[model samples]
Target chain A: MTAVRPPEADLVVADTAVQPSAPPVPPAATAVRPRARPRPAAPRRILMKGNEAMAEAAIRAGCDAYFGYPITPQAELLEWMARRMPEEGRAFVQAESELGAINMAYGAAAAGARVLVSSSSPGISLMAEAMSYMAGAEVPVVLINVMRGGPGLGSIGPSQADYFQAVKGHGHGDYRTPVLAPSSINEAVELVADAFELAERYRTPVMILVDGILGQAMEPVSASFRMPERRGAEWVLGGADGRPPRVVKSLHLKPEALEQHNLDLQAKFGRIEAREVRWAGERLDDADLVIVAYGTSARVARTAVARAREAGLAVGLFRPITLWPFPTAALADLAARVRGFLVVELSAGQMVEDVRLAVSGRRPVTFRGRMGGMVPTPGEVVDAIRELDGLAAGGSR
Target chain B: MERSVIFAGFGGQGILFAGKVLARAAMDEGLEVFWIPSYGPEMRGGTASSTVIIGDGPIGSPIVDQADAAVVLNPPSHAKYASHVAPGGLLVVNETLVLEPTGRTDITELRIPCTRLARDAGDDSLVSVVALGALVGRLRLVRVESARQAIRDTVGMKRPQVLAADLAAFASGYRVGSRTHGPSPDQEIVRTRVHHRVGVPR
Candidate 1:
C-alpha cells in the first residue's frame, strides 16, 4: 500500500535489525469465519498501490516467477510478491541487479514459464540491451516500467517521461515491441492479464508502461482471482520436449538472416495491431469534445468530464490501455463523433501527437499536459474542454 | 452497500492495526474490503493512520476525501477530520487522548476512554478494538457475531484470559455508542469475510 515504513509499523516490527522471527502467532492467529447465509464469495479486495496491483495481476495472469531489482516507486511490486508469490506456489527472487533480472526473465520466458521483470526508468535503462535480446529471441517476457520523474534517478514522483523509450522501441535494430499503458487500477489488473495472452500469442516481449503516480496510488481491486491457466510451451527451447532439440538464442552475424528476423517481428506486430489495440471509452457519443489520455492523466480526464457535464459542456473521454498498438482505429471512430481531440497527459504531448497521427487532420487535435512529475487536474481539462468548444464555434475542432 | 471508516492516531496507538482488523472482519462477513495505510517516513516515532473501506458494490477511489464516520485517537485528528465528516455521521473519539470536543451539532459523537478501557482489559494495545466496539454499537454496520468472530480470527480463544476481556471491551464500546445515538443510515453496510475453517492459502 506504498508504506514508507510508518512509525507504527516500525514499532510493530522494529526488530528487523535482527532477522525477522517467525510471526509471534503462527498461522493459527488467522481464525476461520463461518460461511454465514451462504452468500456468493466476495470479490478479492485490497488497498494496494498500482505497482503492487500490476505485480499481482501478473501473478494472476499465470506469472510463474518474478525477476526484479528493487527501485523506488516499483519496489512494492517486488516486496509484495516476496512474501506472496511463494504462498501462491510461484518463485519471487530479488535479482542481483537489473541486468540479472532481465536475463532471468529471458531464461524463464524461453522455458515457457510466465515470467516478468519490472523497474523504474534508471533501472530500466540498465536492462534495455537485455530487452532487445529478449525481443530478438522471440521470448514472451513481460517487463513493467513504473516510471518516476527523470532522464536519470528522477525523484520518485510520477511522470510519463518514458514515452519515447517505450513506444519508439528504446532498444537497437528495426524490431518493435508491444506496449500497454493502463490508466486505472481496474485497467491495470485487466491489462496485465491481457498482456500475458498477447505476449504468448506474439511470442515477443511486451511492456506494461506505468508512471510513478499509478505505481504509488492506492485503489480498490477485487481480491480473489484464478490466474489464467498455463498453456502451450510445446515449442519452448527447454532442452527436451521428448522431440528434436530447439535452441532459443539471439545471435546473428548474417545480415540477410537478421533482416528476415526483423521482417518476421514486424509481421507479428502488424497482426497484433490489427487484432489488438485495447482501449477504454467514456461519453464519446454525440460529443463536441473528446479528451484523449492514458494512465493517471486519463483518470483526471474522467473527473473533468463530470465537471464539464455539470458546467453544461458535452465532453467525452478515451483512454488507450494499449500504447504500442495505439488504438488509432478507436480514436478515429471517436473522432467521427466528437468535435476535436484534446490529449491530456503528464508529459509534453507525447500521446497527443499519436492522437493527431490517428485523427490525421479529420479533427483538430490539441494538448495540455504537465512534465517532470507534475499532473494536470480536472480543472485544467475543463479549461481545455471550454477552449475546444470555443474553437469548434469557429468551424474547427 | 459500502461502509468506510478512517482510523487515525499517533504512532503506537494501534489505529492501523485496528483498521486491518476491521477490514479482516468485513472480509470474514463475505464482504469485499480493503485496508489502506498512510506511509510515514522510514523512521521511528512517526504518526500513522489507515482507511478501511468495506462494501457490497465495487469500491471506487480508495482515498476517501470525506468520511461518513471516523474513530479518532488524537486531538489533532479531531481537528483535522471533524469538519470532513458527513452531516449526522458517527464520530468515536478517545476520551483519554482527545481532550477537546469537535463541538459539531449535526453529527452524533460518542466519547470513550478507549485507552483506559483496553488497559483495564489487560492490553493497552487493544484500545483500537475498544474504539471498534463503539463503532459497531453506534452504527451496527456489521453484525455482533461478525465482530466477535473477527476478534477470534485475529487473536484466537487460545488467550482465553484476554479473549473474554477483549469481547467485553468491545461490548462496552458498542453499548456506549448505542446509548449516544440511534442508527441513522438508510442502508447498513453488511460485511462478509471469506475464510476456511482449515487454513487455505490467502
Candidate 2:
C-alpha cells in the first residue's frame, strides 16, 4: 500500500523518536488478478442487437407471430424474424403501417396467441391509433419501440424522450400500455418475454421501450427455447374452417357501454399493477445511498455502483425492467430498508419524480440526470452517490 | 477479462470484413463476441473503423471508449487510433497502406506489408485477408485453425483461385503476427467468470 502520513502525525512520530532504524520496506504488491474462474451454469451465447434479441426472446416466449415495417435500426429485428419466423412455421407480417401492424398483433391476441410489433420513432407515432384501440378493446400485444433522436424528423442516434409517450399512453384513451425499458441486449430478450407473460396475465398491450443505439449495438447472448408446437385451425385467424368468427372491433355507441368498457380496461390495469412490478437491486441491502434508474442509463448506473463500492461507499442501483405497472409497490418495499434514494436517468428527472411519489415521503429521493441524448458516465454517477451524505444532490444543484 | 480491438482502414480496404473475420474466429473458439461498425454518416466512403470485443465472459458495453489492441490498415487510421491503444497493447499496422509511422513508447507495434504480401500471394484483393492472417499470427486471439475454418465458412465455394489466394494470404499474415508478437503472455491468464445471461422466448 502507498501511504501518505499526515504532517501532524509525522511530527508526533519524529518528536517522540529515539528509535532505531526501521526494517526495510517491502516492494508494492502488483494488483493480484486471480486465475481462471469457472463459467456460470447455463450461459446464453449469440451475437445480437437489443431489438433482435428482444424479437428472438419474444419468439422463445411462444409468441406465434410478428408484425413490423422497414425502419432503420429496428429493421434488423424485422429482418431477423422474417428469415427465422417462417422456417419455424410462424407468421411474420410486414404490415403496411404501424397501425396495420398493431392491428395484426391485436387480431392475434384476441384469439389468445402471442404476437408483437416493432417500429422506430416516426412509425411509433403512427401506432398511437391502433395502440389506443388495443388498450380499449382489452387485447394483449408486445410493441417494441427502438427510439431514435426525434421530435418531427430527427437524427438516428439513441434517445429516451419517449418515456411519457409510452407510459402515459401513446394511444389517446383512459388506458395504459404496460411498458418495459430494457437496459442491455441480454435483458431485452428476457424482459420482452416477461412483457408477453405480463400482457397475457392482464389482457393488455405491452411495450418494450428501446432506442437506436441499443437496437444497433451488438452483444453476446446464449438464450434458447424449444420451438413451440404448431397450432392447427381454430387457434387463430387465416384458418380453413371457422366455427364462429370473432370481432376485434372497438366501438360501443352507448355512453353506459363506453363507461363500462373503460371500467373493464381499468380493472385489467389494476390486475396488472397488483401482479407485475419488476425491479433489480444490488449492494442496496447495506447501502447508505440508493439510486433508481432504468433503461440504458440503468446499466451505466450499475457500473457506477461497482465503482462506488471500490471507493469505500455503499451505493446501489434499483433498475426497473417493467416501467409501468410502474413498480411502485416494489419501490415502497425498497424504501422500507434504505435512508436515501437518488434517481438517475437519461432524462431530466422525469422518472425520478415517479420514484419520489412511490417513496411517499419516507426517504428523500434525489435525482441527478441529463436531458436529450446525453449519457451520464459511471464516474459522474459515483460523485452523485458520494454527495448523498450531505444532501449534495438534494432537489437540484 | 474483456479485450477490444479496433480495425480501421479506408472503406475499400475491406476494413469491416476484417472485423467480421476476427469476430467469427472468436465465436468459433467459444468466446463471447461483439462486432460493431462506426455509426456516423462519415461511413460514406472515407476512412472506416469497427470495434470488436472478445472475452471468455459476456461482453459489457458494445461502444468502446478505449481499445486494448488495434490493427491499422491505413495511414489515416493509424493516426486516428494509435493514441487510443492502451499501454502494453499490440498495434498491427500495414506498411503498404500506412505511409507515416507514429511510435508509442509503451505499446508494441507490428509492421506487416499486407498489400505487398497479397501481391506476393499473386492477388491484391486478398490484402485484408493477409492482414487477418497477421493478426492471428501475432495476437493468437483465436487459433490459426479456427480462423481458417471461419474463412472457409464465410467464403464457402467462391472462385477457387480467390479461395486459394485468401488461404495463402491469411496464412502469410498469421505467420507475421506469430513471429512478431508471439502468443499473448496472458493467454487465458486472467479468466472471467461467465454468468448465465437470459432465456430467449420460443
Candidate 3:
C-alpha cells in the first residue's frame, strides 16, 4: 500500500481524540415523547415468528433504512421490511447481493440514518468486508445474523457455529462487534429494538444473532415498544454548506496513522467491554456446575438445568446475552465458586474457547456440542450434565 | 405446568397451521407458548412437522425429544411420532389415513377418522383442525372456547370462507374424543389382533 497520508488524517485524529469517557446513557432514560405518526396501533399481544417480530421491532425502533439480500431463515425479515418499510415512509432495498446490501447500509448509516442489514451464514460472510469498513469508519449500523449451519453453504438448519465469526471478529483487523444473542422471539424483538440505540450510542456495528429455529419459531410477543428518541448525529455526512467537509473512511496508508486509528478502535472496544456485558443466570448461587450457553442452546440448557435440579443435582445455567465482551468478568467470578463448568453450543466448539479463557483453568470447562444443524436436546444436555456431575464429584477431569 | 405437542404429517396437511392454532389458543388463555416448524426445502408430498410448547412459566427448548402429546395425520407421521409421545400422554392419529397401529399401550391413543370427519363437515382440508380438536378434547390443554377463538383469529382471518367448516369439523372431532376412552374393551381386542399381526410383544 502507498504511504501517502491524506490531509484529512489530522481531522480524523482530532475527531476521535475527543470521544466522551462518560458511560453511555441508557436508551430508555434518554427517551423523549413518542413521535406523532399515523400508523396502525400496535397490538397489545400477538403471536409472530422471530424473523417477522424482529423486523417489526426495527421499524418501531425508528430504523430509517433497510438494506438486505434474501437468505434462508432470514428472508422473512427482508420480506417483512419490503412491505412495512415503505408503509412507514422509510427506505428498503433488496440489494443485488450481501456485499451491496452492507455497503448500502454503510452509506445510509454514514448519512445519519438508522439502518438495518440482515443475512444468514454465507450471506454474512459475503458482507464481512463492508462490516470491517463500517467498524473502522465508526458508523452506526445494526445487523441481524439469523445463523445457519456453516463452514460454507452448510445447511439451512439452525446453528450457532458463527460464535467465533461474530464475537471473535469475522472481518479483518482488531475490531469487535457488540453481539446480542436472543433465545426467544420476544427477547429477539426487544434486542432488535435496542440494537439501534446500542449502535448509535457506541458509533459501531451491533449484531443481533439468532439461529434458524428462533427465526422460524412463532411465539406471543408484545408489539408495543418505547420508541427511542431520534437526535441529529454530529459526525454524519451532510452538505458542507458553512462547515468544513467531514470525511468518513477507513483508508489510512501511513503505518503510524493506521496504528492510531486501531488504537482508537481498541479504546472504544475497551469501553464497550467494560460497560456492555450482559448475561442472565438461573439457580447459579448454589450450583456445583454452571452450564454456559447462549441463544437457542441456552434455552435448551435452561431446561436441562431445571431437570438436573429436580433430580437433586446442583446445576445451574449461565446465559450470556452479549456474546462480546463475552461476559468475561462475570464468568470468572463464577469460576471462583462453582466446582466446574459445562459449555453447550450448536457447533463443535467455538464459544467454549472464550469460556475457557474466562475460567482460566480455575475450574474444569467441559463442552458438549452438535454440528451440521443437529441441536442437542434438553435430555442430551442433561446427560452431559450427569457426566459432568460425576467428574465434579470425583474431582477429576 | 408445561406441556408440548408435535403435529406431523405430509406437506399440505396443515401440520404447522394446527400447531399454531394450539399455540395461539394457549396464548389467548394467558399461557406462554412456542411453536417451531421443521423448515427446509420440502414440497407437498414431503414430511412436515411442527412442535408447540405451552407453559405457565417461561418455556425452554421449543423442540423436544418426546412431546406430551402428538397429532399425526398420515401413516408415515404416525410411524414416526407414535413412539415420540411421552408415557401417559395422548396421541391423536388420523384413522382414515393411518392404517398401522401405534403398537404401544402406555399412553391413551385416539384414532379418530379426522379426514372422514372433515369431509363430513364439508371440508376435507380441515383434517388437521379436527385432530387438533381431538387433542384438546382429551388433554384439556386449553379451553374449547379458547381454541374456537384461536381458530377465528388464525384460520378465520386468513381464509374466512372455510371458517364455518373448520369450526364444524372441530366440533365433530371433539364429540368423538369426548365419548371415547382409553383402549375400550373392544379396542383392546383390536390391539391384541394388531400386535399378533405386527409381531410386537404386548
**lDDT of candidates 1 onward, in order:** 0.71, 0.69, 0.82
lDDT of 2 by residue, A1-397 (tens): 2121111111111111111121212212232122232244334245466666776667666778898888875787898788768766899999888778877777777776778889988889988988888877767788889987667656666677777788888877698878888666666766676677666666678898886767876765544432334334233344436366655557989999999988887887787777666666555667767878877676567656766777787776677767787878767877887778878766666787788889998888777776545567667777887777557345334
Pick out the ten consecutive residues of candidate 3 chain A with the lowest summed lDDT: A9-18
Q: C-alpha displacement of A390 in model 1, angstroms?
A: 5.4
Q: For model 2, what is the error of residue B182's alpha carbon versus the real structure, in angstroms, after optimal superposition? A: 12
lDDT of 1 by residue, B45-139 (tens): 44567887666533433445557789888787787777767787878888788888788888877777778667665567677887898798777
For model 3, the DockQ equals 0.24
DockQ of each: 0.08, 0.11, 0.24
Choose 1 or 2, whichever is better by DockQ.
Answer: 2
* Per-candidate clashes, comma-separated: 12, 19, 0
Per-residue lDDT of A1-397 in model 1, one digit per residue for the tens? 3323211111111111111111111111122233464345434344456777777777666789899999887888888778668877888879899999998888888877888889999999999998788888899888889987886876676778888889887788776788988765655777687678778888889899988766765555543333565677666977765688887877977999878877887888789878776776666654678888877777667667766877998787777877887888777876777778788877877777788988999888888988776677567778988888887767651
The per-residue C-alpha lDDT of model 3 at residue B14 equals 86
Q: Write candidate 2's Cα lDDT for B115-195 as tens digits.
A: 777766657766778778877777677777878877875565444446666777787777666655432343222111000
Ranking by TM-score: 3, 2, 1
The interface root-mean-square deviation of each model, in the order shown, is 10.3, 7.0, 11.1
Native contacts recovered, in order, as a fraction for each? 0.05, 0.11, 0.41
